[model samples]
Target: NVYYADFDKILLEVCVGKNRLKTERTDIYTNIRHFGRTTKKGYSFKAVIPVDKINGRDKIYFEYTYGEAKVRTSITFLSFQSRLSNKLPESYWIFGNSILSYDEKKKQMIVEPLTFGSHLKHEIKMMYRVARHGRKRIGKKKTLEMLRLRASIKLNRGFGRKDNDSISGAPKNKKPVWITYDQLFKGGDNGQYFYEYMNKNVSDIETCYIINKDTKEYKELTRKYDRKTVLPFSTYKTRLKCLKSDMLFATRIDIRLYMGFTENDEIYVRDLFKADVVCLQHGLTIQKIAQYQNKFYDNTKHYFCVSPKEVENITKPIYGYTNDMITLTGAPRYDGLVGEPKKQILITPTWRRNVTAGTNEKGKQHEYSVNFKRTTYYQIYNSLINDKRLIAAAKKTGYRIVYLVHPILSPQADDFDKNDFVDIVPGVKANYEKMLKESALMVTDYSGIQFDFAYMRRPLVYFHPAELPPQYAEEDTGFGPICRTNDELIDELIKAMQSDCRLEDSYKDNINNFFPYDDQSACKRVYEAALKITNFS
Candidate 1:
């Protein structure tokens, strides 16, 4: 169970091949081989799964093994080629742009992307007129229906349908991929509210994080990165190109995402809204608004803000905003805070804002580096490296730090090379459970993790570094224990380390409209939300 995720979100592999030489075909499974683990006589070939699997300390045990007289997992790199090509259909891609048809006789389906854009791309009247007067060449309604249905299937885990049976025959090992936006530490009322909203609205007790692509990895120049992350699959143009190529060996695509970002500007979202339901984790951040410059959103509808209590004190009522709409649903994560917390302290630092670990020297910035601007990361890093009192206090008090870097930061830094001070990590969803299980001491600067950390009723410490950017003008600093110095901060931290200030009459009853489920039903909440979105069926 890996808590901190790296650039590769997941690494999963499946093994598929016939038992006899008569079934000698080799390109049986998808994904390129990474490494071969074991071998038994000559009965089987052990192929490394293609996706990254995150369990670090505990290796995943398949629990059971299939027919095996021998295993052949070892392979030479000089020539590592998977030849499961002949039996499968080429190009399993079914996207916004693809020509498709089902061949009932052969029980095969063919998809050709780029030959035609999506039927929805045309005006409704033009599309209808084209459909009525001319030959149906292939689709408009049928293709869109299937694509939407595929997304729905992935969302509800196929809701009682036999996903294994395709127009073509069932392949051996096939699993659908489910992905969603991560909102644990996005901060502001939106992030907190959405965190709780997801916990209460979504189901399946799952958590997945996707790192930005700009963060790259390099094997050359010691500290240098090549264009590998961007070269093969970077932009949408490149992604489409790669898809056209991935088509050669693909069997079928279970589901593809427009991904976690729920921008109304997206062609897919705009098309789906009339007939589809959507659940979002965070409302628009200030950066997003500035980036869009009033052009990114449509005035017709607004994003539903689920975590309102987190921002109610500072933000005005957002439920009825005009240009950009927001619904105040109250987050599901904070439901536990309804009465009072046994103890609570949240220490989370903001991610790099203007500067990063490695960057070109043109004074250019990623712009998304919010934390980098408010607090100097390298300085805090130095403080953590040199401070003995802080370290000793953490150790003596049986304190455990819940370090959550920006999800976008991992791609820029290596998990193998991440700071070594972090201690104790339970599985994913259980991170909040970990906070509930252990000490409540939070020490952070400018990071949104502090917002939820406040939801806990324990001591809080804010590390406002000297390097904070002046451009970020805001008067509503969070109300709790705050600090500016090293030694002085430690004493304050020690004082608040074991306190319960969340139950005070001042805030217990005054609730914001944002957060939806403060109780432990976050998973159920999320599952229900997914159901609502998928009811388009």
Candidate 2:
């Protein structure tokens, strides 16, 4: 509703993986073709392909094109970039759609979205090309279906709905959902806190608390993926248990605010069967790249689109769901960071190696050469773990040092030692609310940490290690300085930590536009939407 924005037309540019066509007719058109599975009439959103000619080879495309005859795409690469700005809400900007491209007729090349990667250009182009027909139809909706199919497989493999006798033993409460995270260890792994918090936060509402499933012994979160433990990965058996669960509490409607997650995780599919299922993903650029992997749920009840900004112009094209589907509820994990963002500083470097694609038993796949600048948990940890300067400040200034390790590096305590100066807190399953409540400041690079920190409106010092390859930058982007060495880390961390009330002065304007957590009613907005969708009262 702003005057200037109303007149500001979205800028449409066309650029791509080596313009295969003549420089002339490369105009990026808003007109687009929908890529539906089966007979192909199904197209979620449209996009203006900014390219010469979508060759049959390349996997992705970007920028803009030239010409009137230039494929007038509705929600193509051009439109998404034109409307969305950086720093959109993490939950709103979801990376979706994994199929290469639907032949608009043949029906084939159905694949899952690449939930954990940073090759947007590569994903987009390949998705468009491989989807040329009769190959394997992978649409956003299909990815979701794939999840259900996985669960169905689980049913066949044994993990089915709780037996009638088991249901009869229910604790007077028909709570139909079950969740288990290996990370939470508050009450000596007994999961006593579940009852405590459930009672306090959601008590006497006919609920059952049973976490730390294997707490009879000491099994730390991330100890090792055990099917016998809590919830395992999206395996065949896991799916069945998830599917047969009562639809009312099928899943938590996981609205991931940060980046990186399986497009077809069991939880996502479980939500599909439930009446009130919804997913909150972030990023226009991220979502489009992930398009190929998630085309399955292109037209499902549970599937929805919710990114940081709603990026208005582009999101409207693909996400047909109402604004309710797009709750601006920042993120439950980030709820504590709003308004009271810290003035002090804490360092949280990015963690890589653990999440490598080809990383197998032998070790992380070291062959593939990435195209961006990236730093790993091992590298960053070693570089600054014993840094004399960092230690001195933590001890002297009481800088409140906490290392927020990515999920991959979390369980492996054998790799690094956590001393008095450093506390290794895994980003996964680790309650971010606790981190935000205790700390006054945070420092992180890439990895969805920025989005979580931004909600707090705290001063974040981005440490850009020069040792990392430039291609890593494609992994993530947020405003701040780049620290290349231990010395730079000290200076930045010191300044950020020492400052008492400089956050509002230094990061005020940017935080306002980026996070905008000024109001605490985001949860209310999200809750109401969920109520209307499921009529849950």
For residues 409-471, write the lDDT of model 2, one tens digit per residue. Answer: 544433555676776665444555566655676666565556565655555666667655432
Candidate 1: tens digits of C-alpha lDDT, residues 1-537: 123333132222332221111122121122222343222211212334221322112121111122332222222111101111111122122222332323333433333332223322222333343344323422565334324433442243221224342222111112211222222222222223332343344443222222233322111111322122112212343222222211110111111222221111122212222111122433223321221212111211223333554234213322223322334443334444433333333445555444454542211223233344234554555455236765555556555444544444544222222333344231122245345435455666655444454445444556665655433333333444456667666677655544432233333333222234345444445444433433311
TM-score of 2: 0.48
Q: For model 2, where is the 10-residue window of minimal lDDT?
A: 85-94
Candidate 2 Cα errors over 4 Å, as ranges: 1-212, 215-276, 281-289, 292-324, 336-345, 353-377, 417-420, 425-431, 469-479, 484-486, 504-506, 519-523
lDDT of 1: 0.33
TM per candidate: 0.41, 0.48
TM-score of model number 1:
0.41
> Per-prediction count of colliding residue pairs?
53, 105
> Would you list the C-alpha lDDT of every candidate in the order shown?
0.33, 0.38
Q: Which ten residues in a row have the lowest lDDT in candidate 1?
A: 246-255
